[model samples]
Target: MRDTDLSVELCGIRLRTPFVLAAGVLGTTAALLERVARRGAGAVTAKSCSVRPRRGHPNPTVLPWEGGLINAVGLANPGAAAMVGILADARRRLAPLGVPLIASVFAEEAGGFGEVVRILEEAEPDLYEVNISCPNVAEELGMPFAADPVQAARATAAVRAATRRPVIVKLSPNVADICAVGRAVVDAGADALAAINTLGPGMLIDIRARTPVLANRMGGLSGPAVRPVAVRCVYELSRAVPVPIIGMGGVTTGEDAVEMIMAGATAVGVGSAFYQRGMGALEAMAAEMRAFMQEQGFGCVSEMRGLAHGA
Candidate 1:
């Protein structure tokens, strides 16, 4: 509110603020997407859909710990075909608000990435977030494309060929060198990047029940826990590639978002915070960011970006 500019351009898409609603957090429906947009999200990303429908893992798929939440939602979605209608509806609802809709997609194979993108093109989303790094579905989908530089590039290329829309390849933190995959995807024609989808296929147990907390037994860790890893990944990727980066993981506050921007993120992705707090989290984070910017004398998001990388 101090006239400090939060607007940032991501691959030609101008966001009113630096905070984007990360995919999979209340992104399954048009109403939910609209709600986040109304709540102050600069942009909204729909849940990751595939070429076909998925039942996803059963209940108890998400559990909260002292640090954060572990979830194995298994990318549950209505599939690409059905999602076209959902996305079109979301776009109509979002357009009036001047908020961009970013469609997220994932596939079990390289070519499948393109196939899904083509089908979803009917919805005309402003951007495509090619999710090649979802950690919760490794068993069903096999190793994530983000694990291998070659495979990451291949998936990125597939999505690139299918859409003229800017593509942001989501990366995983479970790899040896995240920068390797980052450079590969950029070389393969990705217009931008999003890093550290979630950390670990970590597990939790019910002490009394003597069973795993989540039915899937393993889930990706998110919330306050993964911010460090996310920041590091974004920092490395920002330096490794020339495109814009959407940094996310456990960003729960405006200070956290600012830390991410200083870490070299063009935009900050907000996910688990919505769960930890509520819809108000976005507004709170935005206020906090503005307060920090005003206090620091930073005029815009671009000025704070990569300050950690020093000249």
Candidate 2:
């Protein structure tokens, strides 16, 4: 962490590193987040949980594609009520490392977001991360909640009203105008933003089995394939919204993380990369980012953030 000058402050929470383990990866338990933090992540977002315990989609929920991987885990998790103990354990486990536990919540309905927030409030999460748009849910309307400014604002407002904890709204990239959605959520009281959730409700065919590879038929696309689009979203939203952005998509390496930061991400989310390179990926990214900074003669992350805006 020393070589990079990677420290950053999101909303009011401070992080020793700018590398965060994105939601829905290895985020179910406090132990997992603790392990990642000890390995070198600045923070970790627990898997997205709902008001009710969900089974999520069936088998073949995750598939490795050519460019990246597709997943429809259905946001499976113990309900918020059940997560209270888990969050408490996570809060305790991360306290020593000084890593913040960002509890990610997803609800089928707008009000449900607030309900889950209230449930986890007692657990004392360092931050509340609301997942307004997950492409895997079949029940969603024409677009995910992050696509509609109205829906995004409503959800953010619900979570904001429910907790005093800093709130981060993770937006989706499937929308035509993600900046509008980001701005709406910010106006609704989101303290920070995580740009570009997985890109598509895409699917793959099991030619050998003569059926769809994923049981859900479609899942969000993530990994190297989405980096370009993710960077674009971060770049645009960085200029449009005033809050900090946690950029993600295909950040598999430290250089990739640097690209995201230059595109306007205050921090970077390492998701599918977690699977591709394993836990060592975080450390690798930090070292690589530091080397890049040294070569470019930049003193810190802030100096490079949004550097692409003018380009």
Q: How many collisions per candidate?
A: 0, 1
lDDT of 1: 0.93
What are the per-residue Cα lDDT tens digits for candidate 1 across 66-167?
A: 889999999989999999999999999999899999999999999999999999999999999999999988888899999999999999999999999999
Instruction: Write down the TM-score of every candidate.
Output: 0.98, 0.97
Candidate 2, residue 129: lDDT: 89
Q: Give a tens-digit lDDT track for model 2, residues 225-278.
A: 999999999999999999999999999988898899989999888889987998
Q: List the residue pairs that clash in candidate 2.
A: 254-285
Off by over 4 Å in 1: none
Task: Give the least accurate 10-residue stretch of model 1, judged by summed lDDT.
Answer: 1-10
**Candidate 2 residue-wise lDDT at 168:** 90
